[model samples]
Target: MTQISAGERDRADTLASRRDKFILPDGVIYLDGNSLGPVSHTAISRINHAVTHEWAAGLVRSWNSAGWMDLPITLGNRLAPLIGAPADTVIVTDTLTILIAKLLANALALRPDRHVIVTDSDNFHSDFYIADGVAAATRRDITVRRTTRAALAEALDDDVAVVLLTHVDYRTGELLDMADMSALVHAHGALMIWDLAHSTGAVPLHVHEHGADFAAGCGYKYLNGGPGAPAFAYVAPQWLDSLTNFLPGWLGHARPFDFEPTFEKAPGIRALVTSSPSVVGLSALAGALDVFEGISLDVLRRKSLALTDFFITEVEERLPGVFELVTPREHHRRASQVSWRHDEAYGIVQALIARGVIGDFRAPNIARFGFTPLYLSFRDVDVAVSHLVEVMHHREYDDPAFRQKNPVT
Candidate 1:
């Protein structure tokens, strides 16, 4: 492989200066942003202020004074530009699974005549679980199709009500064409609901431009919010009034504080919110988003491609036949991460983590590495590859300690 010096690569990166904004640890090269992003210094400060001043001192009055009630809308507006959705159409609320369940229910309601919900076989497992649970409860049919972009198109038919898919595959980091898929679904008179769990904040998205009917994603991943951070949901303006929310909590009421006997849905996307917003988590996510204030999504995409390209090149040259590249080679068909298939994928991931190079292991035989342009440097990628070489040469992955699986991984 043709080696590119870190200095040369860093000099070309417009996002290099943005690294200081995050609170990453020393002596570690983190390649797991797709799993959970490291917290930013701004997020830490925001949490402190929310807890110490807003919650502790302001008491209940803070609900109005601190704009706590509007946190969901406020953060949604901030996140709109990143996902290419319009104002008032997006809201930060609930976990990804909850939002997915709600969106699927609403989508099915929209197409009551259609009985089938089509999804990829390799899409996130939680998404499949949510769909299966909803189908079982509502007596709907679900078709699990292949993961290829072409296979998805073939699986669509008049019977399909909703085509649910992860924008980027979690294990392989394969990016599906949103615009094309949405158009196909619409042509079949079916709505498209994209799970942006592995795509948002890591890649440039156009939810509205791509004609997505509904979308959902987590804040804890590339958004850099704390663990179990509140997730986001999006509904197109046209469906805001037509779609029905399954879990219509009080906050989603048109007049939530009115204590009315009837449940009146709020106007626009606000009606999708099920319960009270997590003020602390929203505050932290707001701070995390501040880092993207002046940054361009175009620049982020370019840097992400460069980082992954460099890592793939290095791995191929250093460890010839040791691993198989699973992520797509084309930039447009790839997300902000890369993956490899090997028999000892789990042990290899453990060995790398032990060496202070963090990546993740998927079931059976896949090792994944994520690249965040905002905080990662080109040098970090080079060092991570070097550590992998050391681990392989030393046969450290064969150690008995690495064979033991952890609860989380």
Candidate 2:
């Protein structure tokens, strides 16, 4: 009996119909959704409505009439279900870096008696930089620790105020068990703060169920809110009144319209909104999220695993020993993406892009491919592998043009 092709697998996929919602480029197989997701038709229409009707016609009155002032909260409430957060616990505002700094500060403030902030050594670089800056400014020690998933529990201790980690490894697409880690941090009397930058929209996350104290993630990647889309932050209900907002701004003020002399924080997650949110960006995000309204995350997660598994199998069977798989092999420990280590990973990624298969290259030697289930199918994975095979066979990656590194990659 002949084996079913990847294209056939995609044809039978229940989520395959979702690809119609996106506006992917013709002849391009986009595998970099973990970095930046392509814009959708809904987002485009929402932006147009916001611009032509809300902004141009309604003017300042649109802030009230079109619900511009409430976009952040509205979007947050809509996005809450995706992250397993309760209503009003998540606020869509600010960039990922700023949110991380604020969350770290609040975690430390909550545990003032504690002096150490523990984090993974392979955590996203910006997260580490922010941790370093916050630790320096607050006169606290930052402990960067690296451990395998099995040994993560050993890294926590009594002195730790908070344990910050990315739910998924950005480079290797490794998934960390949120519930287990959060439990470990709590056992050590440390608050658990998760950076969901890579996990949000790509995998199933039950932030509240896991008992995470705080969490933050970007909207541009799997959320498909376009570039510089506002990020979301989650503060557990238990810590709402206790955690201080050290970076408080006017919007977060309890009575901003009253123009009070003293700063007073608003209730719940609203208190985390330090500044006015970008209305247009929020509109785009709202539109992007509309695509997920009735979709089940379980189905999405299953398709994601299938997509990555197929890609891994194709690569290993067709191009043996050419690249080393850096991502975890276990289904539960893997995110929606796959990464490989190759000496000319940069050039190989460039060559893939040249063939209209848009994967990306990380620093040094990591080649990353992000499989966004919303718009990606097994057929796309099959085509991507075919191009990769050609690139490897013809030594296309060795081209001098691909060898020159771009500033962005």
Candidate 3:
């Protein structure tokens, strides 16, 4: 195998300067951005301003004076371009689970005649749970249907009101063709909803371009928002007018301040807003979007593919037959992460974390690693693989302490 110079590749990287914007810990290589991204100077600074000035000084007046009420839509507009959504089409709001339930319920309203909601069997577990909850809320008027990704295309029937799927498989890091899948669902008169938690920031997304009826994603992952940060949702232009919020709040009222007795929903995506926004979380998320201001998803994707490809190539060359590659090798079919299946995957992940290389373990037998182009470099990837090589050959993961599983993993 030819020796690779990660230093040289990093030095030539145009996004190298973006790394300085983040505050990565010393001597640690972070490879779990898919779970939670590291903090950026911009996000920290923004959060501090919100605490010190907006909330502390302004108090109640801040709702109007500090523009606290508009963070959901305002911040969402900032996130719109990155996801290839039109202005005013996206709104930052509750957790992905809540958004899924709200969107799934609203889909039933759209297709009053339909009685089923179809989703992939491999979708994030929470998504399936939310869909079931939505179905149950209808007094069994609706049924939650599950199908494998390979079989999803043929599963839609007249009773299917919505088809919910994760754009990228959480455990395997496999990406699906958004345009083709969404189109297929529409042909059968069912709404399409996508959970983009894994691909929102690292992969190039075109929600509107792909004709998805609704899309939602988390901010804590590739967006670099802190933990429990607010999530975002997008509604297609055509649906913005006809859609109804399943969980409505005062803020979604046409005249929330009017204090009218009857419920009158606000126009456009604002109708999707439920309850008061998470001011601090939204503030941090808005701050995180600052990092992607002028950055192109296309450029980020190029670097991401390069990093993952390098890691895969090095692993195959050095440790043949050691682990089963779970992520797809094809660029178009891959997300911004990689995973490998091993009998001792949990131990390997713990061992890597003990050595300052942070990755996460998925249930059963998969070890996952995420790549964020905004703050990571070729050198980071190179070092992480080196640690894995040592951990495997030196049997560092054999320590009994690593066998104890944590609650969060």
**Model 3 Cα lDDT, one tens digit per residue, 146-184:** 999889877988889899999999999999999999999
- What value does the lDDT take at residue 284 in candidate 3? 91
**lDDT scores in order:** 0.90, 0.89, 0.90
Q: What's the best-to-worst order under TM-score?
A: 3, 1, 2
- Lowest lDDT sum, 10 consecutive residues, model 1, at 140-149
lDDT of 3 at 246: 70
Superposition error at 357 for model 3 (Å): 0.3
Best by TM-score: 3
lDDT of 1: 0.90
Please write out the lDDT profile of model 1 over residues 1-409, one tens digit for every residue: 5567977898888899899998888898999988999988889899999999999999898999999999999899999999999998889999999999999999999988988888888888899888888887776555434345568778888888998989999999999899998998899999999999999998999999999999999998898987999999999989988867788889989899997988988888888887888999899998888888899988999999999999999999999999999999998899999999999999999999999999999998999999999999999998999999999999899999999999978
Please give the distance, in angstroms, between residue 341's alpha carbon in candidate 1 and its true position after superposition: 0.5
TM-scores of the models, in the order given: 0.97, 0.97, 0.98
Clashing pairs in 2: none
Task: After the best TM-score superposition of candidate 2, give how far the Cα of residue 50 lies from its true spot, in angstroms.
Answer: 0.9
Off by over 4 Å in 1: 1-3, 139-149
Which candidate do you rate higher for TM-score, 2 or 3?
Answer: 3
* Tens digit of per-residue lDDT, candidate 2, span 1-409: 1157876887788877778889998999999999998888899999999999999999999978998878888898999999999998888999999999999999988888888888887888898899888888786565545555566677767778888899999999999989988988899999999999999999988999998999999999999999999999999999888756778788899888998888999887788888877989998998899888789999999989988988999899889999999999999999999999999999999999999999999988999999999898777888899999999999999999999989889
